[model samples]
Target: MHCLLFLRIVSALEHRYKYFRFREDAVGKPGHTPIKKWTAAIRQLAYGGATDMFDEYLHIGKSTARECLQYFCEGIREIFGEWYLWKPNPVDCHQLIDMHGSVHGFPGMLGSIDCMYWEWKNCSDAWKGMYTTGFKGKHPTMILEAVADY
Candidate 1:
Protein backbone atom coordinates (compact mmCIF):
# COMPACT_ATOMS: atom_id res chain seq x y z
CA MET A 1 0.00 0.00 0.00
CA HIS A 2 2.76 2.42 0.91
CA CYS A 3 4.61 1.64 -2.31
CA LEU A 4 1.47 2.27 -4.30
CA LEU A 5 0.96 5.64 -2.63
CA PHE A 6 4.60 6.54 -3.23
CA LEU A 7 4.35 5.64 -6.90
CA ARG A 8 1.17 7.67 -7.26
CA ILE A 9 2.84 10.74 -5.78
CA VAL A 10 5.87 10.37 -8.05
CA SER A 11 3.65 9.92 -11.09
CA ALA A 12 1.69 13.06 -10.27
CA LEU A 13 4.86 15.08 -9.80
CA GLU A 14 6.32 13.84 -13.08
CA HIS A 15 3.12 14.67 -14.96
CA ARG A 16 3.09 18.18 -13.54
CA TYR A 17 6.73 18.67 -14.42
CA LYS A 18 6.15 17.50 -17.97
CA TYR A 19 3.20 19.87 -18.32
CA PHE A 20 5.36 22.80 -17.25
CA ARG A 21 8.14 21.80 -19.65
CA PHE A 22 5.63 21.48 -22.50
CA ARG A 23 4.16 24.92 -21.76
CA GLU A 24 7.60 26.49 -21.78
CA ASP A 25 8.59 24.68 -24.96
CA ALA A 26 5.45 25.89 -26.72
CA VAL A 27 6.49 29.46 -25.93
CA GLY A 28 9.71 28.95 -27.92
CA LYS A 29 12.10 28.88 -25.04
CA PRO A 30 15.74 28.00 -25.61
CA GLY A 31 16.89 24.47 -26.27
CA HIS A 32 15.38 21.85 -23.90
CA THR A 33 18.61 19.90 -23.44
CA PRO A 34 19.02 21.17 -19.90
CA ILE A 35 15.46 20.37 -18.91
CA LYS A 36 15.61 16.94 -20.50
CA LYS A 37 18.87 16.04 -18.83
CA TRP A 38 17.66 17.33 -15.48
CA THR A 39 14.43 15.36 -15.78
CA ALA A 40 16.39 12.15 -16.21
CA ALA A 41 18.60 13.01 -13.26
CA ILE A 42 15.52 13.63 -11.12
CA ARG A 43 14.11 10.27 -12.12
CA GLN A 44 17.33 8.61 -11.05
CA LEU A 45 17.24 10.42 -7.72
CA ALA A 46 13.60 9.51 -7.16
CA TYR A 47 14.39 5.86 -7.66
CA GLY A 48 17.43 6.04 -5.37
CA GLY A 49 20.71 7.72 -6.24
CA ALA A 50 23.12 10.08 -4.55
CA THR A 51 23.78 13.65 -5.62
CA ASP A 52 27.29 12.67 -6.61
CA MET A 53 25.88 9.90 -8.76
CA PHE A 54 23.59 12.38 -10.44
CA ASP A 55 26.50 14.74 -11.03
CA GLU A 56 28.59 11.98 -12.59
CA TYR A 57 25.71 10.56 -14.61
CA LEU A 58 24.75 13.97 -16.02
CA HIS A 59 28.36 15.23 -16.30
CA ILE A 60 27.44 18.34 -14.34
CA GLY A 61 29.57 20.10 -11.77
CA LYS A 62 28.29 20.58 -8.21
CA SER A 63 27.33 24.22 -8.74
CA THR A 64 25.63 23.41 -12.03
CA ALA A 65 23.73 20.56 -10.43
CA ARG A 66 22.51 22.86 -7.70
CA GLU A 67 21.33 25.41 -10.25
CA CYS A 68 19.57 22.77 -12.33
CA LEU A 69 17.74 21.36 -9.30
CA GLN A 70 16.68 24.83 -8.26
CA TYR A 71 15.40 25.53 -11.77
CA PHE A 72 13.37 22.34 -11.79
CA CYS A 73 11.86 23.08 -8.38
CA GLU A 74 11.02 26.63 -9.41
CA GLY A 75 9.38 25.37 -12.58
CA ILE A 76 7.16 23.04 -10.56
CA ARG A 77 6.22 25.89 -8.26
CA GLU A 78 5.34 28.14 -11.18
CA ILE A 79 2.97 25.62 -12.74
CA PHE A 80 1.38 24.45 -9.48
CA GLY A 81 0.65 28.00 -8.29
CA GLU A 82 1.53 29.25 -4.82
CA TRP A 83 -1.53 27.89 -3.09
CA TYR A 84 -3.58 24.75 -2.83
CA LEU A 85 -6.04 24.20 -5.66
CA TRP A 86 -9.29 22.66 -4.51
CA LYS A 87 -12.85 22.81 -5.73
CA PRO A 88 -15.56 23.28 -3.14
CA ASN A 89 -19.15 22.34 -3.83
CA PRO A 90 -21.97 24.12 -2.02
CA VAL A 91 -23.78 20.84 -1.46
CA ASP A 92 -20.69 19.30 0.20
CA CYS A 93 -20.22 21.91 2.92
CA HIS A 94 -22.02 19.91 5.55
CA GLN A 95 -19.96 16.83 4.95
CA LEU A 96 -16.73 18.83 4.87
CA ILE A 97 -17.62 20.58 8.11
CA ASP A 98 -18.39 17.32 9.84
CA MET A 99 -15.13 15.77 8.69
CA HIS A 100 -13.14 18.78 9.82
CA GLY A 101 -14.83 18.80 13.17
CA SER A 102 -14.11 15.14 13.72
CA VAL A 103 -10.47 15.38 12.66
CA HIS A 104 -9.46 18.74 14.15
CA GLY A 105 -11.66 18.64 17.25
CA PHE A 106 -12.84 22.13 16.34
CA PRO A 107 -16.11 23.36 14.94
CA GLY A 108 -14.63 25.41 12.11
CA MET A 109 -10.96 24.73 11.90
CA LEU A 110 -11.43 23.58 8.31
CA GLY A 111 -7.89 22.79 7.18
CA SER A 112 -4.41 23.42 8.59
CA ILE A 113 -1.80 26.08 8.14
CA ASP A 114 1.97 25.71 7.96
CA CYS A 115 5.11 27.44 6.73
CA MET A 116 8.51 26.37 5.47
CA TYR A 117 11.77 28.11 4.75
CA TRP A 118 13.79 27.63 1.58
CA GLU A 119 17.30 28.86 1.04
CA TRP A 120 17.68 31.94 -1.15
CA LYS A 121 20.53 31.91 -3.63
CA ASN A 122 21.40 34.27 -6.47
CA CYS A 123 18.68 36.78 -5.45
CA SER A 124 19.02 40.47 -4.80
CA ASP A 125 18.84 41.76 -1.20
CA ALA A 126 15.89 44.01 -1.97
CA TRP A 127 13.77 41.12 -3.21
CA LYS A 128 14.71 38.97 -0.21
CA GLY A 129 12.90 41.25 2.22
CA MET A 130 9.63 40.91 0.34
CA TYR A 131 9.83 37.13 0.55
CA THR A 132 10.79 36.90 4.22
CA THR A 133 8.14 37.32 6.90
CA GLY A 134 7.16 36.33 10.43
CA PHE A 135 10.07 35.20 12.62
CA LYS A 136 12.04 33.77 9.74
CA GLY A 137 15.22 35.46 8.59
CA LYS A 138 15.75 37.03 5.20
CA HIS A 139 15.37 34.46 2.43
CA PRO A 140 13.99 34.60 -1.08
CA THR A 141 10.82 32.55 -0.67
CA MET A 142 7.05 32.47 -0.89
CA ILE A 143 4.29 32.26 1.68
CA LEU A 144 1.65 29.61 1.10
CA GLU A 145 -1.43 29.74 3.27
CA ALA A 146 -4.23 27.29 2.68
CA VAL A 147 -7.52 26.43 4.36
CA ALA A 148 -10.44 24.13 3.69
CA ASP A 149 -13.94 25.47 3.26
CA TYR A 150 -16.57 24.08 5.50
Candidate 2:
Protein backbone atom coordinates (compact mmCIF):
# COMPACT_ATOMS: atom_id res chain seq x y z
CA MET A 1 0.00 0.00 0.00
CA HIS A 2 1.23 3.50 -0.80
CA CYS A 3 1.62 5.26 2.53
CA LEU A 4 0.74 8.73 1.20
CA LEU A 5 -2.35 7.53 -0.69
CA PHE A 6 -3.49 5.47 2.30
CA LEU A 7 -3.07 8.50 4.56
CA ARG A 8 -5.08 10.59 2.09
CA ILE A 9 -7.91 8.07 2.14
CA VAL A 10 -7.87 7.97 5.92
CA SER A 11 -7.92 11.75 6.13
CA ALA A 12 -10.75 12.00 3.65
CA LEU A 13 -12.80 9.38 5.48
CA GLU A 14 -12.09 11.04 8.81
CA HIS A 15 -13.19 14.38 7.45
CA ARG A 16 -16.38 12.88 6.00
CA TYR A 17 -17.24 10.63 8.93
CA LYS A 18 -16.66 11.49 12.56
CA TYR A 19 -16.18 7.79 13.37
CA PHE A 20 -12.55 7.99 12.24
CA ARG A 21 -11.78 10.55 14.96
CA PHE A 22 -9.70 9.29 17.87
CA ARG A 23 -11.93 10.05 20.82
CA GLU A 24 -12.51 8.97 24.42
CA ASP A 25 -14.95 6.16 25.08
CA ALA A 26 -18.02 6.23 27.37
CA VAL A 27 -16.06 5.34 30.53
CA GLY A 28 -13.68 8.27 30.00
CA LYS A 29 -11.07 6.08 28.38
CA PRO A 30 -9.11 6.95 25.30
CA GLY A 31 -10.09 4.94 22.22
CA HIS A 32 -7.49 2.65 20.69
CA THR A 33 -9.03 2.49 17.22
CA PRO A 34 -6.82 4.64 15.00
CA ILE A 35 -7.85 5.80 11.55
CA LYS A 36 -4.70 4.08 10.28
CA LYS A 37 -5.93 0.80 11.70
CA TRP A 38 -9.24 1.11 9.86
CA THR A 39 -7.41 2.03 6.67
CA ALA A 40 -5.10 -0.96 7.02
CA ALA A 41 -8.02 -3.28 7.65
CA ILE A 42 -9.67 -2.17 4.44
CA ARG A 43 -6.44 -2.55 2.50
CA GLN A 44 -5.74 -6.00 3.91
CA LEU A 45 -9.21 -7.17 2.97
CA ALA A 46 -8.73 -5.83 -0.55
CA TYR A 47 -5.52 -7.84 -0.81
CA GLY A 48 -7.38 -11.05 0.19
CA GLY A 49 -5.69 -11.27 3.57
CA ALA A 50 -7.29 -13.57 6.08
CA THR A 51 -9.70 -11.91 8.53
CA ASP A 52 -8.03 -13.64 11.49
CA MET A 53 -4.67 -12.27 10.36
CA PHE A 54 -6.07 -8.73 10.44
CA ASP A 55 -7.31 -9.32 14.00
CA GLU A 56 -3.84 -10.47 15.01
CA TYR A 57 -1.90 -7.68 13.29
CA LEU A 58 -4.27 -4.67 13.28
CA HIS A 59 -6.12 -5.55 16.52
CA ILE A 60 -9.49 -5.25 14.81
CA GLY A 61 -12.31 -7.75 15.21
CA LYS A 62 -13.08 -9.88 12.15
CA SER A 63 -16.63 -8.62 11.65
CA THR A 64 -15.66 -5.02 12.32
CA ALA A 65 -12.80 -5.36 9.85
CA ARG A 66 -15.15 -6.72 7.19
CA GLU A 67 -17.61 -3.91 7.87
CA CYS A 68 -14.80 -1.40 7.55
CA LEU A 69 -13.83 -2.88 4.15
CA GLN A 70 -17.39 -2.72 2.85
CA TYR A 71 -17.92 0.84 4.06
CA PHE A 72 -14.57 1.99 2.70
CA CYS A 73 -15.25 0.61 -0.80
CA GLU A 74 -18.78 2.08 -0.80
CA GLY A 75 -17.45 5.44 0.34
CA ILE A 76 -14.81 5.47 -2.41
CA ARG A 77 -17.40 4.65 -5.08
CA GLU A 78 -19.83 7.25 -3.77
CA ILE A 79 -17.14 9.93 -3.75
CA PHE A 80 -15.19 9.18 -6.94
CA GLY A 81 -17.43 7.07 -9.18
CA GLU A 82 -18.45 9.84 -11.56
CA TRP A 83 -15.03 10.97 -12.82
CA TYR A 84 -13.00 7.75 -12.41
CA LEU A 85 -15.57 5.21 -13.59
CA TRP A 86 -17.45 6.16 -16.75
CA LYS A 87 -18.55 4.73 -20.09
CA PRO A 88 -16.35 5.59 -23.05
CA ASN A 89 -17.70 7.96 -25.69
CA PRO A 90 -17.80 7.19 -29.43
CA VAL A 91 -14.55 9.08 -29.98
CA ASP A 92 -12.87 6.99 -27.28
CA CYS A 93 -14.14 3.78 -28.88
CA HIS A 94 -12.76 4.82 -32.26
CA GLN A 95 -9.41 5.63 -30.66
CA LEU A 96 -9.26 2.19 -29.03
CA ILE A 97 -10.08 0.49 -32.33
CA ASP A 98 -7.44 2.46 -34.16
CA MET A 99 -4.84 1.77 -31.49
CA HIS A 100 -5.60 -1.95 -31.56
CA GLY A 101 -5.38 -2.06 -35.34
CA SER A 102 -2.05 -0.24 -35.38
CA VAL A 103 -0.57 -2.42 -32.59
CA HIS A 104 -1.73 -5.86 -33.80
CA GLY A 105 -2.48 -5.26 -37.54
CA PHE A 106 -6.06 -6.35 -37.07
CA PRO A 107 -8.58 -4.28 -39.01
CA GLY A 108 -12.01 -5.65 -38.01
CA MET A 109 -11.15 -6.74 -34.46
CA LEU A 110 -12.92 -4.22 -32.28
CA GLY A 111 -13.05 -6.21 -29.03
CA SER A 112 -13.10 -10.04 -28.85
CA ILE A 113 -9.58 -11.01 -27.86
CA ASP A 114 -9.70 -12.62 -24.42
CA CYS A 115 -11.83 -14.95 -22.35
CA MET A 116 -11.92 -15.90 -18.68
CA TYR A 117 -14.16 -17.92 -16.41
CA TRP A 118 -15.46 -16.11 -13.34
CA GLU A 119 -17.00 -17.79 -10.34
CA TRP A 120 -20.72 -17.19 -9.87
CA LYS A 121 -20.79 -17.40 -6.12
CA ASN A 122 -24.46 -16.61 -5.56
CA CYS A 123 -25.87 -18.15 -8.72
CA SER A 124 -29.23 -19.81 -8.24
CA ASP A 125 -29.53 -23.60 -8.51
CA ALA A 126 -32.30 -23.34 -11.10
CA TRP A 127 -30.12 -21.52 -13.61
CA LYS A 128 -26.82 -23.28 -12.80
CA GLY A 129 -26.95 -25.66 -15.75
CA MET A 130 -27.65 -22.87 -18.17
CA TYR A 131 -24.71 -20.74 -17.02
CA THR A 132 -22.27 -23.50 -16.11
CA THR A 133 -19.63 -24.71 -18.52
CA GLY A 134 -19.70 -28.10 -16.70
CA PHE A 135 -15.94 -28.01 -16.23
CA LYS A 136 -15.10 -26.15 -13.04
CA GLY A 137 -16.52 -28.21 -10.17
CA LYS A 138 -20.22 -28.13 -9.29
CA HIS A 139 -20.85 -24.42 -8.92
CA PRO A 140 -22.13 -22.31 -11.83
CA THR A 141 -19.72 -19.96 -13.57
CA MET A 142 -19.79 -17.00 -15.91
CA ILE A 143 -17.23 -16.16 -18.57
CA LEU A 144 -15.74 -12.72 -19.03
CA GLU A 145 -15.04 -12.26 -22.73
CA ALA A 146 -13.15 -8.98 -22.78
CA VAL A 147 -10.82 -7.22 -25.21
CA ALA A 148 -9.30 -4.32 -23.32
CA ASP A 149 -7.40 -1.83 -25.46
CA TYR A 150 -5.12 -0.62 -22.73
Candidate 3:
Protein backbone atom coordinates (compact mmCIF):
# COMPACT_ATOMS: atom_id res chain seq x y z
CA MET A 1 0.00 0.00 0.00
CA HIS A 2 2.79 2.37 0.87
CA CYS A 3 4.60 1.61 -2.37
CA LEU A 4 1.45 2.11 -4.39
CA LEU A 5 0.74 5.44 -2.74
CA PHE A 6 4.30 6.58 -3.29
CA LEU A 7 4.11 5.61 -6.94
CA ARG A 8 0.91 7.60 -7.38
CA ILE A 9 2.44 10.66 -5.81
CA VAL A 10 5.54 10.40 -7.96
CA SER A 11 3.47 10.02 -11.12
CA ALA A 12 1.35 13.03 -10.24
CA LEU A 13 4.38 15.20 -9.64
CA GLU A 14 5.97 14.10 -12.90
CA HIS A 15 2.79 14.88 -14.81
CA ARG A 16 2.49 18.29 -13.21
CA TYR A 17 6.06 19.23 -14.03
CA LYS A 18 5.74 18.05 -17.61
CA TYR A 19 2.46 19.87 -18.07
CA PHE A 20 3.87 23.14 -16.78
CA ARG A 21 6.96 22.92 -18.93
CA PHE A 22 5.35 21.89 -22.20
CA ARG A 23 2.09 23.76 -21.91
CA GLU A 24 3.81 27.11 -21.41
CA ASP A 25 4.12 29.49 -24.36
CA ALA A 26 7.84 28.82 -24.28
CA VAL A 27 7.44 25.47 -26.03
CA GLY A 28 6.87 26.81 -29.57
CA LYS A 29 7.52 29.67 -31.93
CA PRO A 30 5.07 32.57 -31.95
CA GLY A 31 2.23 32.10 -34.52
CA HIS A 32 3.31 28.49 -35.10
CA THR A 33 1.37 25.34 -34.38
CA PRO A 34 2.10 24.09 -30.90
CA ILE A 35 4.43 21.09 -30.51
CA LYS A 36 1.88 18.91 -28.77
CA LYS A 37 2.40 15.83 -30.97
CA TRP A 38 6.16 15.96 -30.65
CA THR A 39 6.03 16.55 -26.89
CA ALA A 40 3.65 13.63 -26.44
CA ALA A 41 5.89 11.42 -28.57
CA ILE A 42 8.95 12.26 -26.53
CA ARG A 43 7.13 11.70 -23.23
CA GLN A 44 5.83 8.35 -24.38
CA LEU A 45 9.27 7.29 -25.58
CA ALA A 46 11.01 8.35 -22.39
CA TYR A 47 8.37 6.91 -20.06
CA GLY A 48 7.20 3.81 -21.89
CA GLY A 49 7.45 2.83 -25.56
CA ALA A 50 9.43 4.42 -28.37
CA THR A 51 8.49 2.53 -31.50
CA ASP A 52 4.97 1.61 -30.50
CA MET A 53 4.13 5.01 -29.16
CA PHE A 54 5.56 6.82 -32.17
CA ASP A 55 3.69 4.65 -34.60
CA GLU A 56 0.39 4.65 -32.72
CA TYR A 57 0.23 8.23 -31.55
CA LEU A 58 2.57 10.17 -33.82
CA HIS A 59 2.23 8.15 -37.02
CA ILE A 60 5.83 8.86 -37.89
CA GLY A 61 8.91 6.81 -38.64
CA LYS A 62 11.46 6.04 -35.94
CA SER A 63 14.03 8.43 -37.41
CA THR A 64 11.38 11.11 -37.81
CA ALA A 65 10.32 10.51 -34.26
CA ARG A 66 13.84 11.17 -33.02
CA GLU A 67 14.18 14.29 -35.16
CA CYS A 68 10.82 15.70 -34.09
CA LEU A 69 11.60 15.26 -30.41
CA GLN A 70 15.02 16.88 -30.79
CA TYR A 71 13.63 19.81 -32.75
CA PHE A 72 10.86 20.35 -30.22
CA CYS A 73 13.29 20.45 -27.29
CA GLU A 74 15.67 22.85 -29.02
CA GLY A 75 12.82 25.11 -30.05
CA ILE A 76 11.40 25.09 -26.54
CA ARG A 77 14.71 26.09 -25.00
CA GLU A 78 15.18 28.93 -27.44
CA ILE A 79 11.62 30.19 -27.05
CA PHE A 80 11.63 29.95 -23.26
CA GLY A 81 14.93 31.76 -22.95
CA GLU A 82 13.77 34.58 -25.17
CA TRP A 83 10.46 34.96 -23.38
CA TYR A 84 11.67 34.84 -19.75
CA LEU A 85 15.01 36.65 -20.05
CA TRP A 86 14.74 39.67 -17.77
CA LYS A 87 16.67 41.42 -15.05
CA PRO A 88 15.44 41.08 -11.48
CA ASN A 89 13.65 44.10 -10.03
CA PRO A 90 15.15 45.65 -6.93
CA VAL A 91 13.56 44.79 -3.54
CA ASP A 92 11.40 47.34 -1.75
CA CYS A 93 11.56 47.33 2.06
CA HIS A 94 8.28 49.15 2.84
CA GLN A 95 6.28 46.79 0.61
CA LEU A 96 8.02 43.80 2.17
CA ILE A 97 7.07 44.97 5.68
CA ASP A 98 3.43 45.42 4.69
CA MET A 99 3.36 41.98 3.06
CA HIS A 100 4.87 40.40 6.15
CA GLY A 101 2.21 42.02 8.34
CA SER A 102 -0.65 40.87 6.11
CA VAL A 103 0.43 37.26 6.07
CA HIS A 104 0.29 36.33 9.76
CA GLY A 105 2.19 33.37 11.21
CA PHE A 106 4.78 33.75 8.44
CA PRO A 107 8.37 34.73 9.00
CA GLY A 108 9.17 38.35 8.14
CA MET A 109 11.55 37.36 5.40
CA LEU A 110 12.33 40.12 2.94
CA GLY A 111 13.58 37.90 0.17
CA SER A 112 14.62 34.34 -0.56
CA ILE A 113 16.87 32.54 -3.03
CA ASP A 114 16.67 28.85 -3.79
CA CYS A 115 18.64 26.41 -5.94
CA MET A 116 17.42 23.25 -7.64
CA TYR A 117 19.79 20.53 -8.82
CA TRP A 118 19.24 18.42 -11.92
CA GLU A 119 20.88 15.22 -13.15
CA TRP A 120 22.32 15.45 -16.65
CA LYS A 121 24.35 13.21 -18.91
CA ASN A 122 28.11 13.63 -19.15
CA CYS A 123 29.43 15.91 -21.86
CA SER A 124 32.70 16.55 -23.65
CA ASP A 125 35.77 17.53 -21.60
CA ALA A 126 35.77 21.15 -22.76
CA TRP A 127 32.06 21.59 -21.97
CA LYS A 128 32.18 19.61 -18.72
CA GLY A 129 33.91 22.37 -16.74
CA MET A 130 31.12 24.85 -17.52
CA TYR A 131 28.53 22.40 -16.19
CA THR A 132 30.48 21.14 -13.16
CA THR A 133 30.01 22.30 -9.54
CA GLY A 134 32.11 21.84 -6.44
CA PHE A 135 29.63 19.32 -5.04
CA LYS A 136 27.51 17.77 -7.81
CA GLY A 137 28.76 15.87 -10.85
CA LYS A 138 28.76 17.20 -14.42
CA HIS A 139 25.28 18.61 -15.12
CA PRO A 140 24.20 21.78 -16.88
CA THR A 141 22.10 24.22 -14.83
CA MET A 142 21.03 27.82 -14.66
CA ILE A 143 20.92 30.04 -11.58
CA LEU A 144 17.58 31.85 -11.46
CA GLU A 145 17.10 34.76 -9.07
CA ALA A 146 13.84 36.54 -8.40
CA VAL A 147 12.76 39.30 -6.01
CA ALA A 148 9.24 39.86 -4.70
CA ASP A 149 7.92 43.02 -3.07
CA TYR A 150 4.81 43.06 -0.99
TM-score of each candidate structure, all chains considered together: 0.31, 0.60, 0.30
Which should have the higher lDDT, number 1 or number 3? 1
Q: What is the lDDT of residue 32 in candidate 2?
A: 45
In model 3, how large is the Cα lDDT of residue 39? 48
lDDT assessment of candidate 2: 0.70
User: Which predicted model would earn the best lDDT?
Assistant: 2
The better-scoring model by TM-score among 1 and 3 is 1
Please write out the lDDT profile of model 3 over residues 5-28, one tens digit for every residue.
544433433343443232324656
Cα RMSD for predicted model 3: 13.5
lDDT of 2 by residue, 28-123 (tens): 987645575566557665556556556656677777676676667776776667868888898888887888788878765566668888889998
lDDT, model 1 = 0.54
Candidate ranking (TM-score, best to worst): 2, 1, 3
Positional deviation of residue 32's Cα in model 2 after best superposition, in angstroms: 4.8
Number of the top candidate by TM-score?
2
Q: Write down the lDDT of every candidate, Cα atoms only.
A: 0.54, 0.70, 0.50
For residue 144, give model 2's deviation from the true position in Å: 16
